[model samples]
Each structure stands twice: as C-alpha cells, then as structure tokens.
Target: MTPRLFAALPVPEIFHKEIRRLQKGVPGARWRPSANFHITLRFFGTMDGKQAEDLDAELASIAMPPFDLTLQGSGWFGKLDPHSLWLGLRPSEPLAELNAKCERAARRAGLEADSRKFHPHMTLAYLQGTPIEKLTRFAERTGGFVTEPWRATHFTLYSSQLSRGERNIYEPEADYPLL
Candidate 1:
C-alpha cells in the first residue's frame, strides 16, 4: 500500500513537554499535539511499495555529521495567508547540510522537490480559518520564544496514514542515524 511519508527529527520528551505547555496557551489555533511534533527534513506525500523501498535505501545512504539543533521561536507559514503555525530552527550549518542531504535523497528516489523552500521549523498548528492580522500579532508576540536546546541525532522515514479525524498520524518505517 502507498503510504504518506516524510523524514523527520523526533523531539526528546523533555523538550516535548515544554513545547506542549506553551502551545496550550495559544488562542483559536489548532495546535499539533506534542507527540506529533517533529522537524520534517523532507515530506514525501505518498509512495508505492517499490518507491518506499527506494526512498528508504536512498535515505540510508545519506551521511551527515550529527548536530545540535536549537528549537526556538514560534511563527506562521504563509504569514500573509496564514496557513500553518511553526517553531523555527536556529541557523546552523549541520542542519542545512542535513536538509540538503534529504533533498538529494528525495531527488535520487525520483520524488519531486518540495515546492516550498526548506525552512527548518517544527509545526505547532494548522490554521483552520484564522485571520492573518490576529495570527501575525500572535506570531510576533511569540517569535522569540525559546526552550532548552536539543540534539538532532537521527532522521526517520515515516509512513503517514490519514484518518477521518482532525490530524494525520505517522509511524516510522525506517530510520537513518547521523554519523
């Protein structure tokens, strides 16, 4: 069966608790639960069995040095349009390299490049019908929000399954560790 999948960095539990606490205070935003929080290096919409195998093989071949990624700040994607709420990743070479590696792997696996440029962020919420003005003000107020830093040790290849519910749940199909 084809699975909706992506490569992601799973946040540690301690960090997860902190993020969840902060997200709870936001008004009118549909926040992603802490268990669903992750930094997606590449999003592969859906793939057949052979394609999934190919993607997994390609991901396994990617080699990058490990890095400490700081999860700081909250913001919205499509600021004017206001579609998604996210937490920004601090600028770091290792993070960039990892992102590039994931992109290359996707291309090699015959997946289309993500239309949106890779801006490292952990998704906090998805706007249902929130207005941009209020969203912008909320994002601005929380922009500099920071918690403890966490290390990104590995990236996982996830198989996402959609339900009739409000959120999509993903399970790891494979994992590639950073060197």
Candidate 2:
C-alpha cells in the first residue's frame, strides 16, 4: 500500500518541555507525542512509488534560505464542535514561500491541487466529543503562549502509517536542506 506522505519542519527538541506543559487542562483530548510535532508544509496523501519518486526529485530541487519561526498562541479547528487543538506560528513570509514551493512540487509530481488553504500550526491534540466550553477556555488560557524563535534549516519528506492503537507513526523518507 502507498504511504501517506507530507513535507514538514520538525519541531526542535529544545522547546519540547515548554510545549509539553500546555498539553494538559483539556479532558478527552488525545495528545500528540512530542516526537510527532511538526509544522506541515503540504500533505501529498497516499502516492504510488513512481509518484513518490517524482515528488522527491521535485522537493529536492527546492532552494531557499533558512528562516526563523516563532510559535505563538493556541487554537482549535472546529468552531461549533472542536476537533483538534493546535499551537499557532507567527507570520513569516519565508515560511509561506516554502509552503508554496512544496505545493508546486506536489503538482509537478502529478498530485492534484490541494484545496485546503495553508495555515501554519502544529497540532497539539485531537479532540473527540470535547466540550466546547473547555476548548474555549484552553484557547483563552493559552492565548499568550509564545516560544523563542527557532531556525528551520531543512524540511523532511515523511511517510506516515497508522500503527497499533490508531496512532500515526511518521518516518522520515528524505531530508531536503535549505542552502
């Protein structure tokens, strides 16, 4: 079976301790392990081997300088019925440009255009029937959350599969450096 693939910048470990502190206070929220934390650039879905190869080549061709990104605030996806909690990122033009490059690579690799607009955030947890009030409170309490700016020097192509317990296991397939 083809693997579900995506391009993302892995969260640096230095900030994991602080990030972990905010993982609590929300009941019934399936917290994501720190190891899985990443700011996704583009999700390419399941791709056959040939398409994967083409994508790898296209992604490797991306040329951009490293940029600094800062984590800021917190939010959830669903307004009426909250689905997931996420940590937001401060606006950065370099980040957006990199995302656009990843999108172009996916298209050049024969993947369909992504319909969802790009929003840069690292998912903190997945919510299931989570109370809207609790989600709101979590958002409010963590509104001032911010991290020291981190340098993103490279992006990775990852293949993810559902392991036991339905948790995603992301394995880095390739690393593309920004030089």
Error of 2 at 79 (Å): 0.9
Tell me model 1's lDDT, rounded to 2 decimals. 0.81
Q: How much lDDT does candidate 2 score?
A: 0.95
Task: Please state every model's RMSD to the true fold in angstroms.
Answer: 1.7, 0.7
Cα lDDT of all candidates, in order?
A: 0.81, 0.95
* Residues 95-132, model 2: lDDT tens digits: 99999999999999999999999999999999998998
Candidate 1: deviation at residue 100, Å?
1.0
Highest lDDT model number: 2
lDDT (C-alpha) at residue 170 in model 2? 93
Error of 1 at 17 (Å): 1.7
TM-score of each candidate structure, all chains considered together: 0.91, 0.98
**Per-residue C-alpha lDDT of model 1 across residues 42-103, encoded as one tens digit per residue:** 88888778888888899999987787878888778775667788889788788878888888
Candidate 2 worst ten-residue window by lDDT:
1-10
Model 2, total clashes:
0
